[model samples]
Target: MKHPKDPSAPGTMRVLDKQPTLQRRSFLRGGGLGAIGITVIPVASLAASKDVAARQSFRHLGAATGRTLVRMARDIYPHDKLADTFYVEAVAPYDAASAKDKGVKKLLADGVKDLDQRARQRCGVPYAEVKTEDERVALLKDIEATPFFKKVQGDLVTGLYNNKKLWPLFGYEGSAWEKGGYVNRGFDDIDWL
Candidate 1:
């Protein structure tokens, strides 16, 4: 007796294939592994838009790199009042740039890998998992002279600070020039100035 041949190959798509995309929320929820992560991953600036625990992804950067960038952005800005979501948003532009340019992709990818490597050398864990603030800051300072660090600094200045939703954290009252300048607004309210 002989076995019959299969109609379609395993894992290949057929006209009526029932496979659902892993990107869908149903996949994560269906899995009973509890939380599928190492540390609490940062959500994108769209913090107000979705379930943050589901995780934020990047087209150019890996999950670990995204997490590292979140830490780097926070270290640079040092905004204890703000959440990691804002730092995630600030670092998101690097991923977008990498998606657009292969050179940028290589630069950022290599830069982040190096940064992570430095962290591992200092401690035993990756950059995002490093416990001490001074250690992380010192690690960043090592790369402060590189183009990658400069690009991150320049982009983050706008990406982190220019966010209207985050302005209140920095005490910026949303561009006083648009409201006829600050001299007549906040300053005027300070009577004894």
Candidate 2:
């Protein structure tokens, strides 16, 4: 289309620019093929699985015992971003130890029973069934002096803190030794502080 008054050129683009180029730009422009619009979908989501149920098995501890330990682990750590599966994974070490050591098995079983009794007395439900976090925490506080409480707390520290996979969730980028230490890196780059 050309204007009646101005007859500079009919086409909007210049002839040299509009014309197809040679091998220099051919590879970049994909010759004549152009870029295909390909949408990629993965077989499964890579993000943390929230709804995935943890399959727990314990030789010495009962099903209720494992469930109670999971709840207790969360009550202690209390990370909102973390899932129940993580708590399950954390408390699983206790179950493994209990299988090998009868003393550990007894300690867990008796402690759980005692805590459940306290919950029943206070809220008319077992410890695992306790509705309020405040009340459950109160129950844990009451037993804080006990060996079982100390043992479980120690187990959780190992299970949670030592995990490399959980490092990213807590904003930890692992030890700085491998990356030539945090001094050279953005050691003070933290904006939240």
Candidate 3:
């Protein structure tokens, strides 16, 4: 078939026969990569996937239950810049110094499990499942009143507070010498130093 723009040349079409020269010039300048381009897709997809993966990774929060604990940590340790860093490290499976002391690791796990179960039994739902802020606060109070809760809270406090990352958050003014120095914390008598 012969086209009007290229009638003299049988079956040959002018690449930019009917288009405006400006549009043609712009298209040619793009090096045939299409007007809007292609390299943007994978980068966008990867960013989205990374966000989803990060959310999914923290699905199991043990006894802490829901993002509320994270919020609580923020409130309790507001000044701690390494709160998240220490928290993630703390929430992971425990790794103590000795192999036989693995029992202590189990004890900590059991303590958290017991606390969560207590919350569920008292409230008819897991602590994480509670919707209202009042309910969460009330649940914490109930836990505090119990011996088991005291024990668990003690262990958790010990574990979490011992974290080097939490020292500054708790106002522990220790030297940052890693582990050997006078941590002259002035929480006691202000005049006593």
Candidate 4:
């Protein structure tokens, strides 16, 4: 009478079987670590979990819009050596500003929509989903003069590149105060006049 899924089980583990409920007291008595509950779920469920996490992560922008912003930011900065994570970090303040200001939110939404529409006209795809970098660059160029683009560029100029976490990536040693100021550090490293 072993279970089909679990050979050691004494019965069949049917799909319709009711999952056991755990009581707090019983859970505590069971040495929780030893009686850890495990459940098998469909891949779709895992995807949904990721979707939920993504939704929570971006407060102001939707996934598609956020993606478009990331691309635009990368284009403006053109830091091919840096990872996408830096771009995401750079755009976080924009997202926060959008969350706090309705006008900013509308501007971002409209900007994203405008970019997508441009992409559609050029390549029949959304801006965020555009496959070719050339097309993306073309689309961005079309909107480069817009206030939306300028705002994004201005915000990212300082926000993205100024991050302390990213300083070391570009050979920046950060503040000189930590190691007893620039006098002791390599402030005078310039030897070749």
Candidate 5:
């Protein structure tokens, strides 16, 4: 029962021997789940802990900071037809940047605090908790010229609309290269004239 690679063990199984083989897709999927605060448990324990994944919470940024980023992304790219998930995805780069750069992290933290302070001064509440849209808009107007706002806005412009998952929803067929360069796949379908 000893692993051939190990010389010390005679009858005991190695740690790798007890683990199941992992596929690349499954591994990436697990990582994605982890990023969103979902725990990937063994399939054997899945039935018993179906609710565990639902209860787990993961936040790349602080809860308040994340909320503010989401709201800001939505404002910058206002699409009433799009779901909140789109806005969340749009702000993911900011979260990632904050994680990698100390300056970015400080910028986000300070920006969120400043926004909350402005909201408190104007509406007696935190920015994320502000009830009136007009008040939130006014608060955003005050900070729109700041470097943090401009950075997030610049990131949102490309990150929000350039996502491949959103292309189909917006009637974008996404690069006809795979279909023979769209030579016969509606490339010349336009006949409005």
Candidate 6:
């Protein structure tokens, strides 16, 4: 089947497809994996290596908790959906968390289902299912201002606002309070002429 991004390609996308016989044959012979396996102790060690590699690649605040934030953020700021990018960074960190991460887990458990239902009711699509930008944003504002939406919105936004990665996504240039985030972002230069 053709890749959505590259219609010209006819077969299934394969990273190895670009390589010639020697590299592919060596890979099949377990060239790299065999060497690494000798150095790495157990099969789980390889998994741990992958986990570390994933964490090193990006810093994800909102997505570190999982798809709950993605769903909520999509609901709230539909047009500026950064969740897809954030999710790429978050997968490892999110999977690393234990069951004891009560704060994030509760936030997801409490808000996701209701938020999804509200999104479906207001827009005729589930939170995860919505396709259009305008419909998503309108539903988000509705969820934020309505009394019925108050509790869940508060919880979800609180979690999102607290995420370390959210600031970059929102263009938050830091704050004047606590540890001088404002100074770090150089908020002192504005002259309102």
Q: Which ranges of candidate 6 are over 4 A from the true structure?
A: 1-69, 78-125, 138-148, 156-158, 164-188
Q: In model 3, how many backbone clashes occur?
A: 0
Worst 10 residues of 3 by lDDT: 30-39
The best-first sequence of candidates by lDDT reads 2, 4, 1, 5, 6, 3
Cα lDDT tens digits for candidate 1, 17-114:
77844332212222211121122333543455342212668767777777877877666656444566666777877778888899988878888899
Q: In what order do the candidates fall by TM-score, top score first?
A: 2, 1, 4, 5, 3, 6
Error of 5 at 137 (Å): 2.4
In model 6, the Cα lDDT at residue 83 comes to 35
TM-score of candidate 3 against the unseen true structure: 0.37
Considering only N, C-alpha and C atoms within 3 Å, which residue pairs clash in candidate 1?
A: none
Better of 2 and 6 by lDDT: 2
> Which candidate number has the best TM-score?
2
The residue ranges of model 1 lying beyond 4 angstroms of the native Cα positions read: 1-54, 191-193
Query: For candidate 2, lDDT tens digit of each residue in 1-193?
Result: 5674443755444434466443321122111211111123232432444333235775469788888888877676665446666677788777778878899899999999999999999999998889988898788888988898888877777787677776666666888999899998889898987
Tens digits of lDDT, candidate 6, 130-171: 676556555555555544345434443444455576565454
lDDT of each: 0.68, 0.70, 0.42, 0.68, 0.64, 0.44
The residue-by-residue lDDT of candidate 5 on 1-193, one tens digit each, is 6666675677555564557454332223112211112223345543554333223222556766877777766555554345566567777666677778889888888988988888899899888778866677677778888987777767765787688876765666889888789878988888874
After the best TM-score superposition of candidate 2, give how far the Cα of residue 16 lies from its true spot, in angstroms.
Answer: 66
Give stretches of model 3 more than 4 Å off.
1-85, 91-125, 169-171, 175-193
Worst 10 residues of 2 by lDDT: 29-38
Better of 4 and 5 by TM-score: 4
Off by over 4 Å in 4: 1-56, 177-184, 190-193
Per-candidate alpha-carbon RMSD to the true structure: 22.1, 19.0, 24.0, 21.2, 21.3, 19.7
Q: Could you estimate the TM-score for every candidate?
A: 0.68, 0.70, 0.37, 0.64, 0.61, 0.35
- Give a tens-digit lDDT track for model 4, residues 1-193: 5446874576654465577775432232212321223323445544544323234357667777877888776666655445566677778676788888989999999998998888888899887678876677777767778889878877876777588876665667888897799986987887875
